[model samples]
Target: MGLLAVPQPYDFERSLDRFTFWGVDRANVWYEGGLHRVVDGREVRITPAEGGVEVEPFDEAIAPVVRKLLGLEFDLPPFFAFAQRDPVLADAVRLLPGFRPPLAPDPFEALVSSITAQQVSLHSAYAVRSRFIDRFGVAFEHAVAFPTRERVARAEEQELTALGFSRRKAEYVLGIARADLDFDELDTLPDDEVEARLTSLRGLGEWSADWFLARHLARPHAWPAGDLGLRKAVLAFYPDVTDVRAAGVRFDPFQNLSAHYLLAALRYR
Candidate 1:
């Protein structure tokens, strides 16, 4: 057990809010007292620390996961500086300073989540996903490891439908899990290539591809132009921006981060 110092301007509450905004589900994550995760066969706990976050049972195996989960690689000063040029973004940055875009610890997990989230209300998605995880995932002390690819690949369509997944969604999940694609190698691909590769898979479309880029790859320029939440948030915040996708072009390389902040702002507002 050890403490990991997060970079300055980190707001644990804001970050936690974003993490749990969808809903509480111990099947995947637990946040009653602190953050808990089961990663690489180890149970790790994270709590607020004076200068950063404190991790229990910290080891090298969990280091990279924590870094990516908390977005340690992203330097926010430049984003905050850039936000000043746009009133909506400036407000979002000010409202949620120190908030960083959270990444999916595993690309496969992100892919599963993207599949589960399709065409459903986030609340419904969360409930169904929670049920699915509780049914198929391996349990830990306070959390469950997201179901493995092998497990999901072998899941029966009827079993998934019983867990609230539509037949099509079940097929999509199984297709992704059984695919020959190497999820780890996706990080090494260029943004366009990543999109092309992901979209090639059955059931994964533009929305899924865009989210994988933003949440899994953490590509700074990746933007989900078709995201309804983002479009609503942009319209609510910037009334003149009739075309959210076109409006997002202004943010360029930082559009992903910008979209994240906008989403967070909408949640808190």
Candidate 2:
């Protein structure tokens, strides 16, 4: 019989709390006993335990991350109102009970990951990234550590491509690593200046830069004008999503939160 163990250390819920706009589809958590992140895929399963929750797939540590993400405790104005009548969106999100994803907190990794994800399937991206990480990243037991510049800088372009990364992505990753400026320096700059610097990389685009800010830096107003999901979700709902610069107006100030709202909303249909 399984002995009851107190949920300790790992906290997925708390991690989820800080991000109001999480790409976390609880189903996407790669659970092989240890918590992992899966791209563009989602799976959810939970069973009862003697003293606590017996969650399948998720590791003990994942609980806090889940709670943190589901930290939307008190209802906000429009969000509260919106949740009241919208059954579709509500149904998809109701299970969370309390979710509050923190703003983006990993600018470098976020940017790099987004670049790898361009026009690719989620699992493919995850697979490619897993290999890249296994090769270049140092072992990180406490939490996932972002790859070091030296590791990335030292890698050959072909090696990355062989791992499913496109030449363009490989170059971009190397370019970023090789650049004199990095997160330490970039963090000191203002948001616009930081974005400008990152955009200077070979494969980086305006959209990718914005994604870095919105997802990793937690820029309140960060918006991705070129996002396919934003456009599709907008068109699917408001129908004015193709308005380009103005397309971002739908969720201006809280564009980051808006992404979450849109995703939560889209999950309805």
Candidate 3:
């Protein structure tokens, strides 16, 4: 098998439209001098050598699947029609470049990680994730591989607390891990069913589940309704609104793409 090495300057400034850009907050990805080295398949390791990023494509057999899975190929509509309606949103989209979603190999890991991220400041969520990775995660070469349920099912709350999780959070995390659930069974069900399964987890609310569904599963219509940033953003554009939830009515068909489009449009400035 052979490999394809492409070096993308890791800037999300105008590129948050990609499908794989998950887990990272917008502001974090755009900080000066930060590079996201995304490795494709197990055979490919994206190492940053002295000269620049190296894309060693060992075992070329699986390159196509890797490319497809990693979103190395796409046909972006010349213009996202959704960006045209609101003048402010249009301005932001123009200012920011377009991007893809950053996804993980394991859906379960992504789900749990996104769960721990609920209702917290971006900094705290990141700190919690890092500490959790350091404790429960394993190093698969460069990437800190999120641990599987079998591995973490037996983890103690005190152990997780030592890793910076709250007592309640630790219990919730362990409960999911111990259940031998991949959650893929819910995938074929309708969206509401998926929502039902996720929000039923203790401590997860409609908003948190909605947030998780939006980023991880790429649900085409999520708007993160209860988010303050979202509320503020919605309000910034509609200063007259006493009910911000109704403001979301403006983005009916394009709600999923609206957040990144809005963020990208407004990110640089």
Candidate 4:
């Protein structure tokens, strides 16, 4: 086993709490105080340890991917310092001291997850997504590798609809899978350009693009003001804030982290 040392003031379990329902999570499995996922075709389990988490059957090759999945690379002190200036944010920080936003490591998986989540309750999304993954994803012992775009591209719209996707969402998923956009090259673009390219696609809109920047690329300034949950979170904490998108400016360089922290507070508090 090898250890991945996340930054100090990190709570491994709390950071991974989003995956608490192991049964519904296909790509990642969180159970028995460990996280399991297929990394480079091999299933690995990560458990909390002294400074960070320990990876069993660890390979140097998959270390970076693991770090990305757990969001271990994010530096928190600066964001913590910034939060101290605001009472609402400061209280959130105190409530969840060591939280880190778990991320979608694969751009394709990230986009697909967003597509699954659109206009649906998260529970319903998880149910449909779980079925979708079972049908299309490559199953491992404890996790499922998300279906490749090529696999999705080849699938008929009816097949996706059968997996619980609404007709339009199914069409959108197929369109994205078959679109000419190179998912890897997206990270090279500026946020505006990224949003432009993504929103130009049929199914993806500004909200999906914003989350792609925040959750997939980990862009520091990405904030999804169009997100209903985020708007609610902002309103709950900042009653004076009516426009969460415009209010995003207050979070500044740490907008992405601020959104994550605010959402986390709503979930964990």
Candidate 5:
């Protein structure tokens, strides 16, 4: 075990709280305990250190994964500077200082999560996803690894439906798993190209693709304009904005981070 330093102004507790929200806890993401599952097949535990968070088993190898998961790659100075210009976002920035947007370490997991979230409350989505993971994921002492594409691909649509996915959603999940979509290749593609490719797949649409960009690729401007929570948050925070897309335009290149802060504001409100 080793300790890795977190970036300045990174609130480990707040970040964990957001990650573990909506009963979406997983063995791989133990927010309360600060343990995360890394792609290199290791579990790292994070805790607050003097000026940063300490990670156990802090092999430099897993540093990138840690940074990605915690949104440490983002330079907040620019975002904070931009936030000060908007009243609603200014208040959000004040209320949720040091809150960085969290990322999905796995793009496949992010897509599956987006598919599960469609037309359902977050609580419901989390329940269904938990059931799906419990049924297919590998379990360890502390956390369960997310099911691989191969595992999910092998499952029948009926199996997914039985696990609480709607019939359409089950087909969608099955389609994605079976599709030859290259998850790894997406990293090299621009946002528009990625969205176009993803939307071409069955059951994937602009909404899912947008979230994949936001949560998986961590694209700074990726905005899910159709998200109900985002719409509600925009309405509550920016009353004059009847159109979410217009509000998104106002945020411009930082719309993704703005969306996250808005969601956090709604939670803390």
Candidate 6:
């Protein structure tokens, strides 16, 4: 077992809530109060521990992957300071102390997950995504690794549809998998450039691009304003704000974390 040190004011369980938010995500399995996920082709069971988390059957090389999974790179002190200025945020911070937004460790998985979530209830999304993972993902002892782009690239459109994807969504997933675009290069591009590049693709839109920046790259200002849950969460706190996307400007540099906190508050409420 290996212990990963976390920054102060980190809530291990709550940060992991998003994985199971829709229910029974195969990529991140919550079992026996421990989170199980594939790390460098090996399944690691993680549990909350003092000042951080404990990883069983840990490999030193995969520590970075584990860190990303826990979202340890995001500094919360600044966000906490900003929260004090807003009544709603202040209350949320107080209610859910140590809350940190988690990231989707894999870039492809992040985009694919976002695509699956489009226009459908998250519960429905989970069902479809779980099916897709089970069909193509490599199975480990406790968790399933999300399918590689190569695996999906070879998948037939009808096969994806049979797995519960809409025809357009199946095309989108396949299109992305087969695209010549290099995901690694996307990490070096500016947010607007990334958005432009991804939106240039057939099915990816501003919403999917925004989430990619937020969840995969961990870009600070990436606010997923088009999300229905975010809209509802914002309305619950600031009913006067009509356009959530426009209101995103107020969140400024911490918009991504702010959006997450608001959604977490709404979910727990």
Give the per-residue lDDT digits (tens) of candidate 6, residues 1-269. 99988887777888888788777899899989999998788888999888888898777777888888888878899888998989998888988888888888888898899899999999999999999999999999889999999999999999999999999999999999999899989999999999999999888999999999998899999999998989999999999998899999898989998988999899887
lDDT of model 2 at position 37:
36
True-structure lDDT of candidate 4: 0.88
Please write out the lDDT profile of model 4 over residues 1-269, one tens digit for every residue: 99888787778878887775323687788768788988887888999888888998888878988999888657789889999998988999999978889888888888888998999888888888888888988888888888889998999989999989999999998899999999999989999999999999988999999999999899999999999889989998889987789999999999999999999887766
TM-score of 6: 0.97
User: Cα lDDT of model 3 overall?
Assistant: 0.56
Q: lDDT tens digits, residues 105-203, model 1?
A: 888889989998999988888888888888888888788878899988888899999989999999999999999999999989999999999999999
Model 5, 51-106: lDDT tens per residue?
A: 77677777667777777887876777898899999888899988987787778878
With a 3 Å backbone cut-off (N, CA, C), the pairs that clash in candidate 6 are none
Task: List the candidate numbers ranked by lDDT, top first.
Answer: 6, 4, 1, 5, 3, 2
Prediction 1 global C-alpha lDDT: 0.84
TM-score for each model: 0.96, 0.66, 0.74, 0.96, 0.94, 0.97
Model 6 error, position 246 (Å): 1.4
Off by over 4 Å in 1: none
* Model 2 spans with C-alpha error above 4 angstroms: 1-97, 102-104, 140-145
Q: In candidate 1, residue 237 scores what lDDT?
A: 83
- TM-score-superior candidate, 1 or 3: 1
lDDT for each residue of candidate 2 in 155-205, tens digit (9 for 90 to 100): 899988988888888888888878777675765677799788887777788
Regarding TM-score, does 1 or 2 come out ahead? 1
TM-score of 1: 0.96
Q: Each candidate: what lDDT? A: 0.84, 0.56, 0.56, 0.88, 0.82, 0.90
Could you tell me how far off, in angstroms, the CA of residue 139 lies in candidate 1 after the best superposition? 0.5
Model 6 gets an lDDT of 0.90
User: How many clashes does each candidate structure show, in the order listed?
Assistant: 1, 40, 22, 0, 4, 0
Pitting candidate 2 against candidate 5, the one with the higher TM-score is 5
Candidate 1 C-alpha error for residue 196, in Å: 0.6
Best by lDDT: 6
Of the two candidates 1 and 4, the one with more favorable lDDT, higher being better, is: 4
Worst 10 residues of 1 by lDDT: 24-33
